[model samples]
Target: MSNGKTKTDIPFRLDRLPWSRWHVLVVVALGITWILDGLEVTIVGVISDVLQKPLRWHCRHLRQVSWVLLLNRGSRGSYRFLLPHRQVREEEALHDHLGTYIVGTVLSAFSFNFASIAVFRIITGLGIGGEYSAINSAIDELIPARVRGWVDLAINGSWWVGTMVGSALSLYLLNPAFFPIDLGWRLSFAVGASLGLAVLLIRRYLPESPRWLLVHGREEEAKEVVSEIENKVSHQTGKELEEPNKTLEINPIGSVGFGTVFHSVFGRYPKRAVLGLWLMAGQAFLYNAIFFTYALLLSKFYGVPVDQTGLYIFPFAIGNFVGPLLIGKLFDTFGRKPMIAFTYIFSGVLLAITGYLFMIGVLSAITQTLAWVVIFFFASAGASSAYLTVSEVFPLEIRAMAIALFYAVGTAIGGVAAPSIFGALIGSGSPVNVFYGYLVGAILMAAAGVVEIAFGVKAERKSLEEVAAPLSEVIENPY
Candidate 1:
């Protein structure tokens, strides 16, 4: 265990720990970022009308610029290479960074002018992008193997919680009868920022990933972190933890480059790469196309007032949130491929039917919103599963990067295109036009579901190491 390399059982030890209060603390601390994101996105959507007069175009440009910058450089292959090293340099720094961004978002809302708003959006986007990589890696490493699926889906689904909060807030804040337009929007941002501050306090107590420590050759530190976790679990449960009898021999590797990540993901696991792209891109297209334009559809087609859009959004968010909470456990019980495919295909089918009804002028605003609730119930679970899939299928060494890469690529292909296309269709004042966009999204989702059926990995209840061996693992001989 010297000369820049070490053999260790740290990964096994971490994976075998029982679910405890400590795990819940980690989930609450880290998973709150998703809620922050949902809140930010919902606020922007709800307030789009308020900004239309003065800052609307500017805000839109800022959003596009921030997304491009973050997706391009933040998730690049080189960026992924540096993630583990960054975590090793300081535990909880990533969490602090996220909190700082939330603070910046609050400040941005108070900006007196337009340029400051753009700057704040970029800062906030960068922080959220960073959180996506770091939090996924940490959660996957810390959670017990048996329950990882349910936990991951639940945490990811929690985004809708923020959506619900934002919608409820907008119902009050966006109302001219209750609050002035300017004050309401600012308060919304303040509320989100406040949540971020609370998350920072909770994250302060989180420890570094012991698997990361052992792989980086910090065996003593790894052992210490694991021992502390075990002690807490034992005290809480009033039972002793069993010794880790399993061991893994890993020959530590030096830094990996973009070429290594490219080769591993595409060269060695080409089928997995394709499956990931399809699943991610499909969900991204469906979600972004609808979510980004939902308010517009309501205001334009249904005659729903802009301020009152939150009334519709509240229920939509509930369905999305409940989908994962209700059915997420089935991914573990029934198997990943079956459940993922079912959600994707089911949602896609439902979306097509809803879109057809919408085009024929048979659906009112209330019915349309209800249709969305039903469609996204399945779609949300499928979307959450997409994140779970990419995070789990890749090797630990490149887990962060893999999540980043898939997210960036998928977002670029589907997320970026969806909004623009949908906006144009909606602008043309034609329901039929929008229906075509829905069909495209629906087809992509269902096709991705088929791809999952063909190629998805059944990763439920399996150790991350067993699912995908570390690039640094040392093979043993039976001779």
Candidate 2:
């Protein structure tokens, strides 16, 4: 019953429309994945108030101070002054463990966050890994080629939207008044989990990328899914979809495997990978060092109100959001090296200025907050763009692995030292000289920027395959 041609021969089918409604749905669903990601990363910030409580333990009896001192004083000159130090006879290592916790027990504040954060960060970071890769691959596959750049920009940019929403919820609904003081952070987590579950549900409707499937030799499945998309688009638009020119298809780019990613990217583009990795690591160090400890820093250094800390962080997050979206486009339009270099250079200078202001005691609360905003703006923008450019410069086959490895190594190094290093520098019980820490961060940031400029590869207008093939040839036939 076909009018002009067989329905099977029709290039654009109802189910596989070029501008299908289904594709739009898929993109939105992918955005939710990232929202969950952002929420997971920042959820603990809202919960720190509750997590800081010290665990309680009951002692069996009040032993005499003389008995305690006589039993267990260590071998030292001070011990000779004391008759003897006594140890509490206790069950197993419980007394030893409890003794450590008891040191902070009498203090007004809590202590669990120091340990809880380590575990929660690992869980949240795992989800983040999946979220970044899944969303990028989904958008690349789903969006049409002509509008791909905009889609890429739009989807990746949506992460900031997710972050802002989490911040708003943390500020308003997740406050202690809405839930029991102990459960306030739980509420924020529940909200984020619910959103994550919703995204998981919606993702069920998304078909695998036809291009990816085709490269894997699932041609029939790819064709069927493509047809389905065309059909959906046609039905939504109430117009027949035009078929893509069949002759336009190119040969399949060579498939990259696990090792191929390292070989292709690091072996061929060693300078770019090294430069990107350093920048990435430095960015993580600075972001975590500042963001994790901002409240304490502001309270002590700037005399900012405790209640206003979230407000200050919100503006910094806004800067983080804006930097990536705008800078990424410039990376696409102009060049990666230039944008990366400019962002880091300015960010470093601003950080130094911020430190100097604090050091000199000339910065008022508002001015200090402004300084944080400016530094974070440039830092976050360059950081995000660096990841984007790194991915684009690798072949599609190895792109995922490259991103995962780079981020994993960079973030791991940063994660381990951020707390201890920043704490030592800022919380050493001396007069708060936060400026010294910022000065160090500025130096590292500027060094990363310079190294990137000297060695970073330009991927301004190249496709992944184009970037990878020549390198492969050089490797196979090096002179």
- Indicate the worst ten consecutive residues by lDDT in candidate 2: 71-80
Task: Give stretches of model 1 more than 4 Å off.
Answer: 1-5, 54-93, 111-119, 474-479
Query: On residues 247-334, what C-alpha lDDT tens digit does candidate 2 reach at each position?
Result: 2123333345545566666776787687768776777677766765665566556665443456666676677777666555666666
For model 2, what is the error of residue 397's alpha carbon versus the real structure, in angstroms, after optimal superposition? Answer: 1.7
TM-score, cand. 2 vs. native: 0.72
- Could you tally the backbone clashes for each prediction? 0, 32
TM-scores for all candidates: the values are 0.91, 0.72
Q: Residues 1-479, candidate 1: write the lDDT tens digits.
A: 33455667777777777778988898998888889888877887777556644543443432442332233222222223344434343355466457656866787678665566655665676567667767777888999888899899999999999999999889998888998777788888888888888888777799988876766666788889988988998888777777777777776554456777888788767888999999989998898889877877787688888789999999999999999999999999999999999999999999999999999999998899899999999999999999899998888777777887887788778776776677678767898999999999999999999999999998999889888888775334200
Model 1, residue 471: displacement in angstroms? 0.3
Flag clash pairs in model 1.
Answer: none
TM-score: which candidate is best?
Answer: 1
